[model samples]
Target: MDTSTGPDTVIVGAGVAGLTAAWNLHKAGQAVTVVDPEPGMGASRAAAGMIAAVSEVMYQHTTMRTLMTTSAAMYPPLVAELTDLLGHDVGFRDTPTLDISAHPGDRDYFSALAEVQRAAGMTVERITTRQARSLEPALSPTISGAFLVSGDHQINPRRLVPSLIEALETSAAAGGPPFILLRRRAVEVLRAGEDATGAVTGVRLDDGTVITAGTTLLCPGVSLATVGGLPEADCVKLRPVHGDILRARLRPGRPPLLERTVRGMVDGRPVYLVPRTDGEIVIGATEREDSFDGVVLEGAYQLLRDAQVLVPGAADLELTEILARARPGTPDDLPYIGRLDGVDGLVISTGYSRHGILLAPLGGHLAAGLVLGTAPTEQDAGILAATDPRRTADPAVVDSASRDPSNGHRTPRERTAP
Candidate 1:
């Protein structure tokens, strides 16, 4: 909260989104500071860290595919840089992803998804159940269909997060950007201008401390979407899409269950298995929109059942961790990642849905560009339009007015929230 050591930018969340932005800005010679109640402990901590730009095409939108592809492509350089900075590997694996389905409905759905991916310029090849099992002998004998995608990869956030933190802290300690993390919640965004919404002056912490910055990037993930007093808090509607994930360790002497990331759909639900190098595997993610409390029960059971149905060896592994966290989901399935309508010096970079892990690097880069007043390239402009925070604020096709605090800017609506 001290202005003497004030940062040029104050990032509200220290998750992957915020961290990457801070790192990029610091590298660009900008003094940055990130604040969070609990850093590295958000949905990023619970994520499976899949960078499947092509294989996990959930929608048939060009913008989504473009963003995913660009984001996934930034990982190699990003990982290498982070590894060197922290003197440790960030756990990046350039493994192929196997898509399989045992049921008729799932097979049909995967087939349709492949078509969409192909239309989006993804290289996909259809394979028989025999070939699928040949790649991974552990695959269930009942698989009816499969697709092999070559462009997808994975990372371990468990390793990436710490490396990122240490790098930033080390830079700050050596008199770089003075980048620091405030272990406090951001209660509100301080505003200035005759209308009191012209420029964001700083952030008021929950502990009654005011940390002023030239600009503020709000990346507080999904859990803080409903928090009051922040600009556009209401405009960016977020639903906590809770995911129940299971981490298991194979007993000693057992070979790897699967070589690559295996995604499957049983019935109408989707599931995936991500293998790690330490003889551990991550089986995820049962999606539920009903509750934020991560109680392990039906969803966890279903993930295990479905994963076992895909890979029989899943049943024999020792379950290590059952993680349940809600992803900040937008109604339109796109993130809010640009400046506010009338609120200068404030940017929104949350609502990533399930692609937070993959999009972190790009999100941070774009956000820093916005703060530095750099002109976005032709492609970046389109992405900004798709994720504009003002889209859901007012129904008018054009911005008739600046984002006024009096008009409940604190409660901007998600495009379509029930």
Candidate 2:
């Protein structure tokens, strides 16, 4: 398979990150081609598309908070562009989110959090448990405290993915765009040198075909461990955090399960429940760092169990599907996004952890800007530097033993192995 003449950019992984990059680059007049075996099947389709910034911010993730908030601010325009191009709505809605406290004793903590967020100029209102239940009637009356974040919003990622693919194909067919979607899995980065300094010319798919492109962006999501040519240490360290998400079809006259994308802290762990415009309530995710990729875990069931505990009506809803998705997580929970140190023409865009959906648009925009040498904003520049692969001590390191293709869901066995 000869892939001699390459497109302007070849993106690996068709998840939200790769799609967003291709879209932004195409809009910027750059030829782009995207490759992924799963395409719409991977993590992108499994995302809950919650654009909750201030409400979801963990104390240690200030940088992520900045990027998430900034990118979230761009949602209206971005959603409008895609919706117009697709000639349909992607279920984007700006309903305020309620961060409810499941335990009565945690009211003070929730109150403090709300106070801090409000003082930071975020649009969150401290609400009583009654107000919280009023906003989301399905919520359990057991809620003790809640904070309403007016800026938090949500979109159906399932709908958004198809819409994006449609827009990408449309642009390509019109002959004004060079975005191509190749449904194949990338096995390794094609390089000339044995060292990381060797420039990545393209990629070799699982099949015999070799795609040689000028630039390659790694957006393989949790599949990052499967890619060759990356440092072995990095792969070993790259953990797949599993999230169990459940989808439920709304009953007639049930009212909205959530006015906005709602998140709750139960037992000091975070869980989010998002309601889509199409009357599907998405409740997810238990965060466990495991290798259970592409499989549903019991934790997902527990998510619903816990969700019902927080929102009593959840027990009455019909569950349509359960998704066990892997989020590429790091020790610090920050994404390793930036240009690889020694590999030229190869950029790392994976490792977004749980924020992949919310971070997609801005990550694509800034990455494309970096590649084109266009002027980036102050914040963009800082993020690029922080996520650079060069910051890692060694770039060419590879560990075949560390690659676990087993269920990417975290398991008790693997948990104690490392």
Candidate 3:
């Protein structure tokens, strides 16, 4: 098989991450082939597209919060580019978020979180309950307090994915772009030579066709565990964080339930209501770590109850869809977007967890640049280092993915003389 005559790059996974990377690389004149079962599908299919760099912050993830903010910064330009190219509105909503609370205790906790977000240089303003209600009249009227993060925005992944898929197809048809879509699962990464630890050559398709490439990017999200020819044992521990999301329809002649994305705490659990321009509200996401359990009635009930605690109108809205999918995750909540230590021609760009939509632009572009042998912008490099695939494991003095010193990666073997 003449591998070089094949696509310059073969991205395994046609999710948003893979599609975005393929688009970016093809724009740079690289012949990119994306391998997957169905295009524009994955954990992202159910995502609400909250680019909540500020509102999604946690006590332990301050560093990641900032990088998320950076990733959030990339959306406008990228979406504009896609919109112009595809001649479709991609549904990018640049609006503020109302972080509200149903009770006094939740309000206090939210107050502390606002201060933490402000300390991180995020724009946050505390608004009285009346002020919040005045901004969006859909409040439950029992809402105690609210904080507005004006910078946190959202896009319709439902819209974004289709537009991206169409854009890729259109770009390819327009003649200059070499984006080929392959409908198949990649079973294994093909190594270039007989050496067990040699650089990755390409991927072997499930249909037995071999498409060699200059580089192979594993953007398969949660299915990373199932792919062969990669040392999963040494790679970052990827787990499935299942989320159950609900979709509801806002009745006609009624005011919108959410003028902006409403993120609130109800009974100490977070619930978000994101209203689409199409009059459908996305109520999400009960997260259960490492459990791929199907949608539990209890989860749906909780989502409904929590959502009602904020708006009180969800009780009357019609149910649209109940979605359950496992978002790929890592223990440290950081994605691996760089080369694996010394493994040549390979990159792992998954473990996006819940931040897949928010981090798609950053991860896609960074992985594309690395594939092209280009470096990240100075700021992105710092964050990428923290999420580096070759991160040294706990007290091991060697990166988990770099255990094989023979893979052109320098491991701990040099502790002694040759």
Query: What are the lDDT figures for the candidates, one per model?
Result: 0.80, 0.72, 0.80
Task: List, residue by residue over 111-225, the lDDT tens digit for candidate 2.
Answer: 7666656666787788777877777777887777788888888877787777888888887788866777888888888886765447888888877678787788888877787
Q: What number of clashing residue pairs does each candidate have, in the order they appear?
A: 5, 16, 0
Q: Against the hidden true structure, what lDDT does model 1 obtain? A: 0.80
**After superposition, which runs of candidate 2 have C-alpha atoms over 4 Å from their true positions?**
3-5, 193-197, 230-237, 252-256, 294-298, 394-418
For candidate 3, report its TM-score.
0.91
Q: Compared with the true structure, what per-residue lDDT tens digits does model 1 show for residues 1-418? A: 3343368998889889999988889998888878898888888888889999887665435566778899998999999887777776778888999988878877887788788778767899999999998999999999889999888889988877778888988887877777778888887778886756567877888777888889888898875654455655677777888888889999888877888999887776678899988888998887677866665699888888889888988999998899888788875667888876667888889988778999988898899899888899998888888778777676452232223322212122211110
Q: What is the TM-score of each candidate against the true structure?
A: 0.90, 0.87, 0.91
Q: Model 2 misses residue 22 by how many Å? A: 0.6
The 10-residue segment of model 1 with minimum total lDDT is 409-418
Off by over 4 Å in 3: 1-5, 252-255, 392-418
- TM-score of predicted model 1? 0.90
Write the residue-wise lDDT of candidate 3 on 56-76 in tens digits: 776545556766888899999
Assess the local accuracy of residue 34 in candidate 2 as a C-alpha lDDT between 0 and 100: 84
- Pairs that collide in candidate 3 are none
